[model samples]
Target: MALDDIRARIRAAEAAAGRPPGSVTLIAVSKLQPADRVEAALDQGQRVFGENYVQEAQRKWPAWRARWPEVALHMIGPLQSNKARAAVELFDAIHGVDRASLARRLARVAQETGLAPQVFVQVNTGAEPQKAGVLPAEADALIQECRQLGLNLAGCMCIPPDDADPRPHFQLLRETATRNGLSGLSMGMSADFETAIAEGATHVRVGSAIFGARPTERPG
Candidate 1:
């Protein structure tokens, strides 16, 4: 199955990059995938998953979590400040913390609930207006803000422009994380995970490759 194949590739990539095996975590992106498929991955011993929508996850994950209590779910999509508390309660890690407002909200929620998820500030390496990430130049300040707010900031994440080479973007994210004393690099998707691993990615979010493509119309 693709889950096993992806893990094997990760191990091989780690060896080629002279990194220790199990250094990188493969987040099986379960967003928009069917329950049966996600359960199949659980049966295959995949304990880490990534989701994009808070409501979708809220609707599905609690039931799934009851069965797979050890699963770690990551929020890998744009997070709204309005959903901060829910996100804090649901995710083990959040990879889309990109703004001050969202960070502040997350901080407040954490303070109220005493539950904070590991966070990765999303950096807009391409400076794409439509993208939901902090500008590359401002990522430092955002990281600092998150830290000051008492959020558990683990690292930096980026989604390179689809049309351009992702290696440079990956390198940029790695450098940002390194300068901030962060160790996690949550870049790379199915197409360029190997390159991301070479560039020091500690977590790679692979969806379609593992779960098959998401349905065109998500079920209500």
Candidate 2:
């Protein structure tokens, strides 16, 4: 019922944003949620998913996909260069590529494994000192660098400052993607996804709003 309700909300957001009927990808963030809930979503036809940790995803999704092979898993959290190979192996998309070094690592691993995942370069639109993204100004260069490394550049992703009005940040990410000839903009979360859709977000990562709060910050 919650999944259906969320989908309805997303469709309404799409309509309100003047986007096409299926312009947005609704990635149910399953991190910190249990595997049973994930299966529930899968039964509800939610194939695209987002997870924060490689090990936690590794622990849960493989067996599920064996049964439901069409699932598309996305890595939507901070990525370590050391985990590039695993990310490439497991994720269908990586939405947290924030630096050139990590890009290079992923490129090399993908070339070696021949399993390159779709990549989204994260931009710190608000220039927040504590966030894990390339500054907005540096996004162009990093995107170009990612292209140079031969990554499958799907588009740009950003996490706007939670306390600020996220619409401007979403617009900036959309413009950055367009200027760079990219088609995807992965912005927004549970709170402002409707506004993000209005500003042209192609992907929205929603976790707690759908699955409810996690008992712990990290997966057990």
Which candidate leads in lDDT? 1
What lDDT does candidate 1 reach at residue 108?
A: 93
lDDT of each: 0.94, 0.91
- How would you encode candidate 2's per-residue C-alpha lDDT over 64-118 as one tens digit per residue? 9999999999999999998888999999999999988999899999999999799
Q: What is the per-residue lDDT of model 1 for residues 1-220, given as tens digits with 9 covering 90 to 100?
A: 4999999999999999999999999999999898899999999999999999899999999998999899999999999899989999999999999999999999999999999899999999999999999999999999999999999999999999999999999999999999999999999899999999999999999999998988876545
What local lDDT score does residue 74 receive in model 1, on the 0 to 100 scale? 98
Error of 2 at 157 (Å): 0.4
For candidate 1, the 10 contiguous residues with the lowest summed lDDT are 211-220
Instruction: Give Cα distance to truth, residue 117, candidate 2, Å.
Output: 0.6
* TM-score computed on alpha carbons, candidate 2: 0.97
Distance from true location, Cα of 171 in model 2, Å? 1.1
Candidate 1 residues lying further than 4 Å off, grouped into runs, are 218-220
lDDT of 2 at 90: 98
Every model's TM-score: 0.98, 0.97
